[model samples]
Target: MERFWKPLLHFGYQQAMSCLFPVIIFVSLAITKVIDVPHLPDYDLLFIICLATQYVMYRSGMESKDELKVICLFHLIGIALEVYKVHHGSWSYPQDGWTKLFGVPLYSGFMYASVASYLCQAWRRLDVTLVGWPKPVWTVPLGAAIYLNFMTHHYVYDIRWVLTALLFIIFFRTVVTYKVLSVTRRMPLAVSFFLIGWFIWLAENIATYLGAWQYPNQREAWTAVSWGKLSSWFLLVIVSFIIVAQLKHVKERREEVPFRASRDSGQEAKRQA
Candidate 1:
């Protein structure tokens, strides 16, 4: 029993560490909602807090520069989505802030960044690797289509379900291998996506309650987000995973290239001698 519980405890600890960014974001949201900070709007304050936390994480070596880049990319992607969604009445930021852009707070992007941060952190902490990953030709296009559908669905027909079906086809054989403590574990890539998406949905509930943003129905009172949004989060998670996976693959290949060059040069010198 001790043996069984030990790995579980370690896994939990690693997961908590992996969630540092998101946990901070959520805590910031709750505190700002309840505590009145004089002259500092809640949204703007949250933004400042996020920036400081990110810098500290990088300076302390908790997050690498590359991970920070990924988080920034997600931040921009999120801001664009927020702008569009707010315009279309999908959700609204009900608070006032100087950082508002087109009625959406600039700090809102950090919510999306938090998701990317979690994925990067968990990947590193768990020593995650993918087996049977599909080619980028398949993944890149799929991720693009998924993100496009998020906006295009409002104007044209929503093909999210179709894209999801394609996800099943593309990653059908992929497996995620991860290490926790002294044990190694494997999970189907699709299952991992669903699990992450479900947890994000749970987090969304807490975030919404703390006035992160509100759906049409949530404007007047706090309520659970629709279950339908789970599918949206699931697709978003795939996009995030694909981007990270491709970047990690490219980084590994680049690192390997220099090592291979040195080895080949040494072999040539030996042959010449």
Candidate 2:
């Protein structure tokens, strides 16, 4: 319908911005051999995908006062985790060639930017109904992600880590949900971001598991066989759906409705009095 075109056009512009600069970067990288075009890891391509998604969220028009804290949290979480993992030899590359992105370690900026970008985008696009502030179990997914990051990589058989991961996710979800505290069409950006962000992460996990990119000393994702990988995927997809729904469609609250004439009427009455 005619009404639909407006948002679509907006989304189109957003989608374009999301991809444009990245494309230029990709071309430049390729031209100068900044990033070798390879099948493994797919870092450059993934980064672009995330960037596009971020723009999509930008176009979605969702605003949160807490957005800055959320973004900062991502930087803190991402850089810290990456540094720690690399420190512990949790995962490593076979060669030492990726050392050019912003003068940080090869995977450092790209990884953090990729992850944080997607999170912010998806958060902005999440269904308000699903992302309650200070909710009951929001952290479940975040913690799971961190936990999976650890165990899945090193084959560390720590049951405690698994439990801790689950608990962490629950706590994270709780905190995020608490921020909004109600599941409405007005969920916080963090929850939505997590939903979509995780799906993209699943892509990385699946690809790596399939040997599309090798993680040193890691086996195929057979552990997923034991612990219900498919279920996790399903949950993640469901969360993504909530986010997509929020991004594409959401209901307005009564107070949110601008009362142009009504406001004028109230103002006139106040002036007369």
Candidate 3:
């Protein structure tokens, strides 16, 4: 029974790979035209690629399902909050083309996946530390502070999503860094990716809407940014750092048995049958 279930789980994950992942990338980019993905939504394509990337990170070791759930929550919640702000008019899109009729932009989910894929790609090299930036005084505030000074004329309002994102950055820089980078950690890439991605949404909650970079058919918010804008940018940098770290941890653990145990066991069991 033990052998049956273990191998079954392994087979299940593999089967899932043939479909579970990659639903976002190919489908989204084609729909949004961020890049040239065909319109079919490439579930298998994305899933296989994600599987490969996930495996590379697995060298760091297997993670718990629970951990993946937490990561997903962080990503989904953070992103959903961002869409709320975008919908509320705290910021605006560059073009109507990229904007969706939904409360947030449709491409928002793609943005989430893009960040996740990037993290998985580098799952091997993405280590992080919360230590003060090399020039802590400057690095601490560069993301937001720079944006604020650069766009003083902008209308940077106080959005809860942006604020939370900012707070998460500070926490990540000084706290979450060690947890994600260390081998003992068990959260899946999804959870780590989501938290880190949520942080990204939190930071960009305003920038994307405020015209930090214009979307299709959207007008730039010349005087739209405020102090809060800076906070959002700051969070983005921190999230980026952590995602990379998780990716690294994944790469480092690949050689270990637990990471690939399921796959091997599955293959062996199939042969026995």
Question: lDDT rank, highest first?
Answer: 1, 3, 2
Weakest 10 consecutive residues of candidate 1 by summed lDDT: 177-186
lDDT of 3 at 120: 39
Best by TM-score: 1
Candidate 3's C-alpha runs over 4 A off are 1-71, 93-101, 120-123, 126-231, 237-273
lDDT of 3 at 254: 71
Candidate 3, 31: how far from true, in Å?
8.8
Candidate 2 segments whose C-alpha is farther than 4 A from its true place: 1-69, 97-109, 126-157, 160-198, 205-214, 217-273
Candidate 1 segments whose C-alpha is farther than 4 A from its true place: none
lDDT tens digits, residue span 1-273, model 3: 975586556544443343222333344324434433454333333334444544543454443343344335435644564566565555444433323445444444434544544443333233333333233343345434433432332455534355455544544443333222233233332234445445455534344343333433345333433445444444443444444344444545675667589889999999999
Number of backbone clashes in candidate 2: 32
Error of 1 at 22 (Å): 0.3
Where does candidate 2 have its weakest 10-residue lDDT segment?
175-184
Assess the local accuracy of residue 106 in candidate 3 as a C-alpha lDDT between 0 and 100: 43
TM-score winner, 1 or 2 = 1
User: For model 3, where is the 10-residue window of minimal lDDT?
Assistant: 176-185
**Each prediction's whole-model lDDT (CA):** 0.94, 0.42, 0.43
Residue-wise C-alpha lDDT for candidate 2, range 43-117, written one tens digit per residue: 445445444544554466432434434434444555555555655564543333433232223333434443434
